[model samples]
Target: MPERDTIMRELHDLGLAAWFGGSMMGAVGLNPAAEEQGTEVDKARVASSGWAKWTPVNAAAIAAHLVGAAGLAVANRRRIAGQKGVLASTLAKTALTGAALGATAYARTLGKKIELASSPEQEKAKKAEKHPISVESAQGQLRIVKWAIPALTGGIEVLNSLQGEQQRPSRQIWGSLRRLASA
Candidate 1:
């Protein structure tokens, strides 16, 4: 493989790692931690604070994924024209990444709502059983983003293998890429 190709692969791998890790952290660590820290009334505030703290880190991870995706696109642009599987994989990754981004934004908005409810005036609003939106929505959005990372990353990996195959002279693209990566 060319040095540029290898470098691009490494960057893509790094981005995948970040995307997966950040999603996992938000879903498993931060969300759970916030839940454990507060009562129903205060839960949103707590969760929001935790997520707010996590925002910059998550942003960095998403940025890494974007950079890696750009690298992959640049490296594989020529080969993608002839590879149906590669094209499909790319499309899948793009869709999943977009979903993850949307979910992240939704989670952030929910977090902000939680923070808003933390105020003294909002205390009265909180006491109403159905007034504050269900925590389930926030949790669900986070879950969507969390699962999306792995699904999308996995798709990218498959796509990467297909791209690698297209570069080879004669070996079957999918099988060869998998074998080479495994070895």
Candidate 2:
């Protein structure tokens, strides 16, 4: 049995790496830099600008990851269906990906609110409704949501590791036998 080509695996890994690294850098570096610029409003503006610049690249990375994930899933469907724990772990990873996407969206929404609230234009401020909470409160929530993106993506990384281990020939055979024994 020869090792298969790793192009899709590399794509998946690189995309996840970017997602995790970018989120972490934003939370750690960008946010703090924005905090240092000046007043709370300026902080929001600075942070929003940085995030706006990152949005396209981040989106691309996510798209690549989704495509790679689908390719891998389709390639390994038989193993996933037959292996003992692969199905559960794959489902967990899928759920986590959904949660990460949701968190990222929520963070962007909070960021837009902050951007508007901090804007100089009265019309823009009026257009960007904070809803149910004040701008300051929204900022607090945004902090949590921003951090959560990295956290959830990091969990996906761990799950990816587990999936890799499950693919080892010995483990695959053991898992299949275990499934048969249970049945």
Task: Output the number of the lDDT-best candidate.
Answer: 2
lDDT of all predictions: 0.64, 0.88
What TM-score does each of the candidates earn? 0.66, 0.92
Q: Per-residue CA lDDT of candidate 2, range 72-167, in tens? A: 888888988999999999999999999999998888878878888888999888867635567988889987888899999999999999999999
lDDT tens digits, residue span 58-122, model 1? 77767876776787788777555444455566777688678767766765666565565564575
Candidate 2 positional error at 135, Å: 1.3
Model 2 error, position 53 (Å): 0.3
lDDT of 1 at 137: 64
Backbone clashes (count) for model 2: 0
- Sequence-dependent TM-score of model 1: 0.66
* Top TM-score model: 2
Error of 1 at 100 (Å): 1.7
174 Cα displacement, candidate 1 (Å): 9.0
